[model samples]
Target: MESFIILIKLLCAHLCSDFILQTNEINNGKRKSGSKGLLFQFIHSITHAGIAYLFVADWCCWLIPSVIFISHFIIDVIKCKCYKDSLSTFLADQFLHIAIIAILWFSLYGDEIKLSYFESFCSVKVWLTIMAYLLMLRPSSIFLNLFLNKWTPTSPNTQSLPNAGQWIGYIERILILTFVLVNSFEGVGFLLAAKSVFRFGELSKAKEIRTTEYVLIGTFASFTIAILTGIAITRLF
Candidate 1:
């Protein structure tokens, strides 16, 4: 129970520091390859570490926050230098952050994380869940994007907000995956129906048959990937 409480506090600190505390200006600064960017990242990492330590409040466990701060800074720097605002980068960044937290948690509570606990963490169900989510997010998005790219409209519609389609596709796949995981297959049908109804006007007004077909293909492909991934997870687990 004490370890669980610590885990919750760490997660809260992560959420607060990463999303609540980080501002647009700071984020932008961190993305740039300059002194200012490094400064912003340093500040962010320090704040994150401070919040984490505040939650744990153990002087003997000082190394945990120190590790978190250093690892967080390095990961953020690498992400800033290597990737931009894309699904892969976003997922990778969050994964690294969570992985660091988990590592630190285990380190701080080494006695609690025995062989049995490690086995449970590495069990089939846990792996299946992780795989299902990964498929539903970046991997599925990449596959669907590539599959639809062949039919992409020559003159793309610039009126729509940037990355809106990508985000929508992600959400749709995640929901479908969730429904499948929970054995709520009926919910997937309802979700599809709702989406089609909402897109009815857009599809109807499409000037080109090619455009309409492209949208349909992309939509169905996204759903297919999600459904298959969910099925695989269910069967395997």
Candidate 2:
């Protein structure tokens, strides 16, 4: 009963409320029009994270609530790609759609559950929790490209700032790096898919596989970091 309520609260509070509202703005093409409500923009950082959470929670067989925390971390990575540009609106849509999936999972799992709420509650240890999860979230390749752009060395041919074309090349490099880091050899399935999708953005078999790979990486990173940090804290304290 309580567990069901907790799931409900998570969907209503975090997934639906935040993710849906933000996604709508993008779909309606209001992001560039500059008329989106303040509330949507304020928490745009957390939109896509719900997808990663959904992926993990589904894998956990509906036994975990920690996915709520992880969702936000993943959202931040996706948000990194928007960076207050025209892409912001579409980014919101993608994130909210993922959240909706998570909500459906919550509903499908139903009322009763058996996990320890006490230990779950106790895992909220500020820096340890946030850092561990964010590490797992792995920022998006487009976002990584944006971050790298800030520090990319100037081209010898052009003394001025790097043009959009150069930045596009830089973005590709970052994507390649991201693919290498996330997929590895065991992730050959995802590597092929990611390579195709990044080369041509949008929904395709490759994009879906690549997205799944990213989710797995984030989930693994979050769980490993959280457990290791918990152990370290227990030993030290």
Strongest candidate by lDDT: 1
Instruction: Score each candidate by Cα lDDT.
Output: 0.79, 0.41
lDDT digits (tens) for residues 1-237 of candidate 1: 356446656766776677667877888889877798899999999999998899777767888689889999999999889876665676778888988898788777856634443344334365446546655765566556656666888898889998899889989999999999899999999999999999899989988798778888998889988998889878854
Q: State residue 46's C-alpha deviation in candidate 1, in Å.
A: 3.1
Provide the clashing-pair count of each candidate structure.
0, 3
RMSD of candidate 2 to the truth, in angstroms, is 15.0
- lDDT of model 2 at residue 47? 44
Query: What's the true lDDT of residue 19 in model 1?
Result: 64
Question: Where is model 1 poorest over a 10-residue stretch in terms of lDDT?
Answer: 113-122
Candidate 2: where are CA atoms >4 Å away?
1-86, 113-116, 122-137, 144-237
Candidate 2 residue lDDT tens string, 1-237: 344434433434443334334454443332333334333433453343444345334464533333443454355444544545334543564466456545655665554565655554533333233332232222232333343444443432253365643344334333333333333433434544664566453324433464445434433333343344434534432
